[model samples]
Target: MKLQTALRLIYPPRCVSCGDLVESDFGLCGPCWRETPFIEGLACDTCGVPLPGHSDQIEHCDDCMRIARPWSRGRAVLTYKDNGRKLVLALKHSDRLDIIRPAGVWLARAARPILQDQMLIAPIPLHWSRLLKRRFNQSALLAQELGRLTALSVCPDLLVRPKRTESLEGKGHDARFTTLDRAINAHPKRKHRMAGRHVLLIDDVMTSGATMAAAAEACLSAGAHDVSALSLARVAKDA
Candidate 1:
């Protein structure tokens, strides 16, 4: 308690999104808080996209019905736009560990329905070359923090990315999948841990779902009973 007080006095508190002053840590200023598009209310059972109007029973989104995801379940806390996109960009460029605290809290609430006692949390790994340059994997940070909050164990080493694929920034949908094909797999020595167990894969963003699809397939091929994916932000056409 004393330590927190002293730190607050020294560093003060700032909004993780807009860098505005706030009352305390892990918070957003009033304007920034309202600006953030937090996904809540009725959402898709499969992809976590907010549904139109109100519903009384479980429902899946149109996209989930037309296109199937490799993972059995999925969750996303916010749409990948506006403040949400800014948050991701800030984490990559600036030293903002505070961003993960609020992200983990939002993710924990979104993933509550899929989390289970025996499930394991694993992050999508960056290729060694990229990891060396970045110094840290943002996805792993989110997974570790979320694991602590949810009392779930995280296995950061369970997955391996042997080759660094080209950036998907300017690629078409098919091109993106071609790049990820056979690019991700479970570590041979760690396969035993995944078999017959549910694995929750974590990532920073889910733009087209290609990365998570590959991760889910790899885990399933290694005998995982089921795989689910969650991301902090997901690109969407609408809520």
Candidate 2:
């Protein structure tokens, strides 16, 4: 066996999606990688939610109109289930910085249709307490990776998570919205940077949409011409 191969075997890389052993650092087994749902076809032009059972020409899911998302549009590379949850947890808790590169590259490629027109990238910032506890911000890592893939500048200081709130576990939509409504603030120093720019707000996942909503609100308040969101995954509403 080749020395490099033997050394790799000694350390045996594991897949991020399924935890299967692999020979390289791809973070997913070939099958799991292929199975990750890349949201496609005619989706809601506003929210990126797939229009199920509709023709390819269909656009705008009912939820988009009912809830009224603040961002102009958004897209996610995966549904937040199965392997996606594993990958997200690994990236957020296990310090898998390498995951950011491939995932961000994939997300950028998936979002090419819209992201190509965006002028600036800003990550949804974490509250200082959360950042201190985690020692890093997953959104920042994703923004860096997306910047590397898209050649767009990542402005990290544009948004600030001003206050920490209790965990959102078991929270309903109204409660989540209330908590997030008070958590984010626009950085005054960076307000001028948003003027007349189409901003791409990057986050690791879109759950109840409250966090992104707050961030997008801050961006709009700072004078961004328009704002859009791109996330690695979206939490599917339970059936």
Maximum-TM-score candidate: 1
Candidate 2 residue-wise lDDT, 32-90, digit = tens: 88776666666666666555665746367677778878898888877777777777888
| Clash pairs, model 1 backbone | none
RMSD of each: 1.7, 2.7
Which residue pairs in candidate 2 collide?
44-60
All candidates: TM-score: 0.93, 0.88
Error of 2 at 215 (Å): 0.8
Clashes of 2: 1
Give the TM-score comparing model 2 with the true structure, all chains together: 0.88
Candidate that scores best on lDDT: 1
RMSD of 2: 2.7
How far in Å is the alpha carbon of 165 misplaced in model 1?
1.1
Candidate 1: RMSD over Cα atoms? 1.7
> What would the per-residue lDDT of candidate 1 be over residues 196-232, giving only the tens digit for each residue?
9999999998876789888989999999999988998
- Residue 55 CA displacement from its true place in model 2, Å: 3.3
